[model samples]
Target: MTTLSSATPRVSPWVLSAFWFGTAFHWLLLLLILMPHDVVRFVGEGQKGTYLGVLTAVGAVMALVLPPLIGARSDRSGRRLPYIRLGVGVNLVGLAVMALAASALAGMGGFWVYVLGFLLVQFGNNYATAPYSALIPQLVPPEQRGRYSGVMGLLQAVGQLLGAVTAFAVGLLKLPVLVSFALIALVLLVPALITLRGVREEGGAAVQAPRGPTLTWRQLFAYQPFLWVFVTRVLFALGQYSVQPFLQYYNADVLKQRDATTSTSIMLLCIIVGSIVSALIGGRISDRVGRKPVIYVAGTAMALAALLLLVAPSYPVALALAVFFGLGFGAFTSVDWALGSDAMPSASSYARDMGIWHVAFVAPQLSSAPQGALLDWGNAQGGNLGYTLVFGIAALFFLLGVILVRNVPEMVGRRPLTQPDGNL
Candidate 1:
């Protein structure tokens, strides 16, 4: 009988791929289902942005704090799956509350309950995400990270395409929105079940025991390569997220699209198409060329896409812009993880450090409300100059991120980072 080595654990790419597909389905729906339109209906029309932003902000606070702590715990226990299951359970409870609140039994009282439910989901989702992402570096050898990231991106695009298409179809059918939500929830559960039953984890190999001195938060901050990556990601996210939550409104008010749902879904499909193509190729390109070059191309394309969207007059033009945006975004998403994985200071603190890195992903929540308020204030002056202005600013943010990324002294795919004197 052969015993598994602590340093190397056999992890199935298929299982990991399945897990990402399910998680993408779960995550995208959780965010999308509570869009500005839903908030306007539930909370109030004029204050939709405010209410949506506030709820997300509150939820984000939990997301900000929970992931790293849970990740640290997972690191110590060397058990990622247990924490993953616990997060799923917590999210289900939140989803249940949300479903019930939206039901006839809850009535207007459901609004507050919905808020509570969403916050719970945010907590659980973030906690789960931290551990789940940490698995990539733990399982895959360094050389293969880009390929795996690409495949994961491919599945993510599929899940997103399915979610968007189904959302449009469900709206056309005039089924209860809650029913659609239930369907998305059910879809999310498939991966959870696969992970629990089919995915194998050797407890000792999941994470290693900390060696010598424990890494302090301040020390983590001092790691220059990672610090730059973290900052660049935050800026990129700010640009990306600022426009995402409000695209529906842009269609309805700016483009004068009567069928906002269909329009939104169509644009999403365009994005999916571009993302699928680029993600499939971009990861491998990064592997051959370098992560930074791919990211540079992605950032440049995104900024240009945003500028185009700002001036886009018709739905067709906007649809074209969405494809460009997706191309850039897909490339970024495909290679970004490989870059971060390379920057990890050590394996022992991967979860905790990655959890901190995850903050860049969610920290956009902090600014989302303010940006929404800016939109409202601009609209108050008449004309939808607000949308144009916000998107323009978002473009600048993307450009700034592109500039900042160059500061990180990193080499080509899977190449080691070292100082001038050959020190890491």
Candidate 2:
């Protein structure tokens, strides 16, 4: 098996191409079934918020454990490509299973099957995610991490475009429940294959798995930056994502929009377009100036945009807010992954470290469930305050991120920090 040593120092064209192809489907996987009413109806009579929260939470919790283990094994085994291949293959199967499961038990409220498929998707996604992610530090030059992250941000925005198209087709089919999930899963395969081919992992033929820490409190608390990042990540993400679960609901009830999907779709599409623009601009900005400024600007913008939705009337105006938020988010998103790469206290343990970062990402799904429940609680109280309350909370989370990120200065621009002390 081959590991980090095998890849060329300069960014491989094939590797960059792989990133462009591989990551496009991830956003859709998260955003596709986010509608409040739809999710609630599918789960159970009294279990919408809890169901949605658990679904989101499970992904995070899995990330917490799986990625680090996979990363450690990959890093030590000196083979990344095979795991990447394996992970992609698993992801494809999981998506197919999810679609099939959802279709089979649609009317019967076969929630377990759906949940089962979702868990499979989570497993497969990180199987690839932890290993493929470790490659960032290996392939991308330290100073250029931000630009690469921007490139990723560009691809993420593009994914939203793909999702809009995906949703449109589903709307036309008048399909049974959300069975179109299968079609979406099928679409994911193309990119996975291309990426698997395009980005060759460092090791493909050697075999020697590195032993990792067993489950224990000590093992969990071993890393410093990872610990700090995870602490901030769960709190911040829960707050930021608190609003997304309710967007469709907000449009229907609070905004009085007739077609919730159409209205939100436009806003989401605008976010996609605006994000693309910001990623390009942000790439240059991070390259010329630094990542901290970009992150600060983006985080601040998110707060303002979320706050705007609180008072905005009409879909067009709301989309206008999306444009602003998208720009901010684009800047942040483009470099967010790269920032994680920069904060590594030890590159030898890159995968393990990144797994912690992944935990920061996935764990929040659970914390944010309460935010959704809060909405359900409000709605039961004879008001449409759920969405508004969530968005306000999300704004606060964004602001907090802005504050926390400043302490971790930018390492992806200007000059590479030579001392290894994290002082850029």
Candidate 3:
């Protein structure tokens, strides 16, 4: 039988920060690329949302199954590196395939190749993220998780800024789209490589053996607090995801802006700024008060932002709304993981639990495609009613998200794994 440490050793501050930076950079880079701008460019205006949504939905199906299974396997074996390394290899290959597909569609378009490429990217990245997030509980002591989460939020802000800047730079240089994407891959890979090399988990010396009866889906979801978190997340995520991919399209198609890229970039820039401020403060605040209150505040702020967008007359007004939304989202991002860490059903199944929790984000993608179809449907009816309706629904979801978490217990500023320690 293998022996494992009772307590997880805390990771050094600098190394953990660098790891966060690398992970954020990689994720933000992918998000920027997958935004509506690229999709509309290839698939055309009328169908871009639906096409992108469809592709995302299709890919999400694969992502839904893979992460949890992989995370569970890692839990059993007491290793994340091997899986993470495999993810990196898969991700690189997926990016290469995507670049090739994008190149082929330089003229009119080709759907299947691009779809396949995207699916592979989803599979690779989601595989990596499960293990990546699982590291948080291992690295940060529970008392300081809020602070660590804050730092992560700051890195995420920086990464968002970097991703937007890179996108603008690619456009300004007028590089071939495929080449631009390739450059992004290179940029993300640098820090990822560093993270892989530099950050090492403790307890590798003694591998963990699975303890107790096997975890089951039914038993896992039965944990009420986790269920509440998942429900709130899925609702808010649906609202947020439904709106994001449509922003650029709404600007160019409905608002009729020739400089759509610049406009979009400005809004994104504002979001980055807002996220930076909240991320720095929100996590620390949650530590003192509680995660639920912070999330409530964040959700309300986001709802207000959505309402403002629904009524805004011009791009400038929309820009202002973006800032508010960013602030809210930034705060939520900072505290959410800390809360998840607190609410985990089992320490042994951290990665697996996180993987299941990830479905809140993933399931929303499936709705996004249908939401796009809804947008197209609304436009067909005239008066841009579709956009208005969608924004309202988004706001409603945010509001409901705030309310749903009201009853869930808070776990801020408490030690993690109080129940028992596993080999991991």
Candidate 4:
């Protein structure tokens, strides 16, 4: 048994495997069971963008409010497995609901049924997410967190990539839409049950550390590093989504790809494959060399690559640029997650603090949500303006990211576990 505190011990391989299983299940469901495909069929043609935005905005809102509260509750309860168990159950059922709604597409279903199902999937995702993520800091010490976070990142990219393929397969199968949800549910349950088996909680209620600062985030964030890093992440999320949500549209409308679906399938596969390699390699490298140096390189590389995509005349060149961007994006993303883990002043409320950190990812939706408006604004100005302008905007964020990464203080160096906050 591996122990973090004097109270109880946590071990690996089992816990980590469990994490991967749940990760695969979650993304698989999103692409195949819940997202895209059928829900939009119900939206009147003209209002599809508005409806999708509403869907995204709703999830963003939940992302902002719920995760921190759930984290705090887990801290208060001094338990992680119970939360994980409950989360897995809800996630399975939510996928089941979404499958039902998807199969009903073009059938006698009403709009409300689709809306209800999407909401179920999204809301349940939040419920499961908040607690599950909170468990990471509790389990892994900082030295190993880079490798661990990288592995999780790899799982995420692969899971989502496969999920999209699977969803497309379902599209081919002409299977009842509900079967898609059943697939998601099965994937979610299998690993979740395996996860439950080996996940014994660490730490004793009797030996809790002297509680760290109870200061509200407003007060705590007065420290510059937190504010600065958070801002950088926000910018990255804004720029990232600005390009991503519309990539299919951009390919179809702008690139004039003869087969948009085939092209997108190829592009996503390449990007995800690159992301997996980058995460695995970058995490280990940063741990050895330090985090900031990698961030600087990633930011610059991605900035340049984004511009290359904007100007590429042919699909092959554009895809090449995407692979370039993926390398930089993956490096930064792997290290960035590790960096977030290192920056925490308190691991006692690991989820709460991590939630605050991740708000950088989620809150940017408010600004980036108007990607359509930004694209429209660019189109009015003409001459490949939207992609050009958006890529430039994303590049600027990467540039700012370089500046923000300069002096990140860490709780531990990447090679050894150290608790600067004295929680252990």
Candidate 5:
């Protein structure tokens, strides 16, 4: 049986996972802070949820379409770094456009401009991320993947933490929106540069070229384990998006916080703290006990936390549930990557396959777009019923994810590289 080289040089997991920091930071900052603020500024608080949903849905569509094409292109070219570089450049342009739109344009016109910028951002981010995700499969051995995934989760959580802090400071100090946009650019650029310099493919070479023709759509769909992983991920993302995009509004309308931004940041801080702790622990534990168990526990915790948040009664209770949710989320994210890596059907098509898997993450936003309208309608009926309905649905998604994940067979110690046929 073939095995990866035992003598491969050890690269720091932090260096390997550096770009994830930027990825997590920018998305959290945009979703949790800037987008909500801008939507309200443009559309008014009454219709902010609906407008935000439309914008996110549009952006999500762009995100869904770009990555697979870009990934496939990179796979055919047998190069990933150039795409990453190109993506970063494009992402910065989007940020600049968004800043100008928000500052110069006004009302719905500005919103439309902002949407154009956002679509560019999605295109660039996904272009980078699809190839970037292949690094673990290319670099790390099967035995070490769980630990590497843990590091990824840790960095992602920390990025989110920093994003929350930035949001808090921006709100407290009344910092200009451009400052926040500049920070986003900085966060994305620095870590991406680090990853570009610090990481390398096997023996400092490009990815191996495919020996056979690429899988057809029918062949791809026939890959059962990969499909299971995709389905499970879609369900999990559904749970996450159902709540994440509307959190600031939730604080304002449900908790009645005078400072909704600060409250939302505080809640995110709790989630980040819990995530940091669990990410460090969960990835390593999965290496020992297998991915499914960790996912089971993590999914259950998240579902319960979402349920608890439904009747949280006060800000403090919501904060506590956020931590619990974070713990689950962190563990799930860490193990989730490892699981996806394990289920990869083709070693040569790593980027392309990973990009398809990534769609699971963004596709949920399409389904979740309705949530914004659902929230509005429920709130219109009084008793903060929208919050209850959304949170309940989130919990259901989480629970379903936990149950459906059982269909994916565990393949933790089995290395995909060993199988020339690309069958796990």
Candidate 6:
């Protein structure tokens, strides 16, 4: 297990969280705008939702399997930055391949080619992210985790905001698809470079020695706090994914927006604004008050916002509801990493544990993939009932997250499981 000394110098939270901006930028741009736009172009409006769902679902398979394996490899090797660098290079290659498919091909052939690229992107991103997720737990003390998590949330919100702006510009100006892809690669590269340069991992005995046996699946499941955290995250993510992938379609089909891309970007801008504010506030507040209280508030806010969005009378009203949703999301994001860190059963396998935790994020993509068909079916039946059904489900998931989180006891200021007498 990695241990921190009281005399160890503290790194700035911003420096530690720098890579998150790039990560958030890459995914938000791809998921919220680029991929959806491409799916619509390739598959036509009638089947866009179904096609997009299938593509994301297929890509999610790679996302689910690769992270834990890569993370375990990095954990064993006692190295992280090299893996991050390699992952970035592979991710860029995937992005370039996707650009080629978008620019050169048409129809299902192009979509299939894009799918291959998406798989690579998922694999590469998760490869980096699994190890990267260990930084906070490895570096920061328990008392300071809330502040570090807050910084992460802040950067993520900013990244998403920038991604929204980029999407809007691309759609409004009719920029070449390659140009947008290039922008994603550029944004992704810079922050990763910064993180590689700025953050330093402790070397020698602390990292090289195995604390004990590597945790088995059975042993992992026996840790009730970790299980609860994983379950709560899964439910929260399900609610989020249910709404996220279908927003552009919602704008076009339900709101009758002529330029759905631009509209979605605008809505995202509003959401990100709310997220930024809450992220900055929520993390600091959690440090003082506790993680669960903040999470409870956040989940309720999101659940209410989801419900409100369902009955929103107009596009403007929907945008307002989106801001409310963002507040909850940002607050949740701020404390989520800290909570997971607190619940982890082992300190020696930070990356591996975090990689398994990451499944909570991608599993939802797989779970919610069928919602695309539901959206199509509901639209086919008239009144766009699919949107309502999905959003309602989202609300339910959020509420469940609020409830299940209670099972994980707060470990703030407590000694981690690395100590023989420590309790999780």
lDDT of 2 by residue, 171-205 (tens): 55666544556555555666666666655443443
Ranking by TM-score: 6, 5, 1, 3, 2, 4
Compose the digit string of candidate 4's lDDT tens values, residues 34-139. Answer: 4533434766434443454455566578667766777677667666667667766666666666566666665425555655655666555555565566555556
lDDT of 4: 0.62
The C-alpha RMSD in Å for every predicted model, in order, reads 3.5, 4.4, 3.1, 4.3, 2.8, 2.4
Give the per-residue lDDT digits (tens) of candidate 1, residues 1-424: 1111224435665567666777677666556544555677776657766677677677778888988898888777766777788888788778877766666435457788888888878877777877787777666666777887787788888888887777778768978867866876787778777766654565434443323234677766687878898999999989977787777777887889997777887888888788888996888887787788888999999999988887787889889889988999889988877777777665665678788888987888777788778877887788888887889988999999999999886644343322333233
TM-score of each: 0.92, 0.85, 0.91, 0.84, 0.95, 0.95
Q: Write the per-residue lDDT of candidate 6 for residues 322-394, one digit (tens) a residue.
A: 8988999999999988888776676667788889998888889986569898888888888989998888999
Candidate number that wins on TM-score, 4 or 5:
5
Clashes of 3: 0
> Residue 264's C-alpha lDDT in candidate 4?
64
Clashing pairs in 6: none
What is candidate 5's local distance difference test score?
Answer: 0.85
Which pairs of residues have clashing backbones in candidate 4?
103-177
Candidate 1 segments whose C-alpha is farther than 4 A from its true place: 1-9, 105-108, 203-213, 411-424
lDDT of 5 by residue, 87-188 (tens): 999999999999889887587888888998998898889889888877776567677789989999999999999999999999999998899999999999
* TM-score of candidate 4 relative to the true fold: 0.84
Candidate 1, residue 348: lDDT: 65
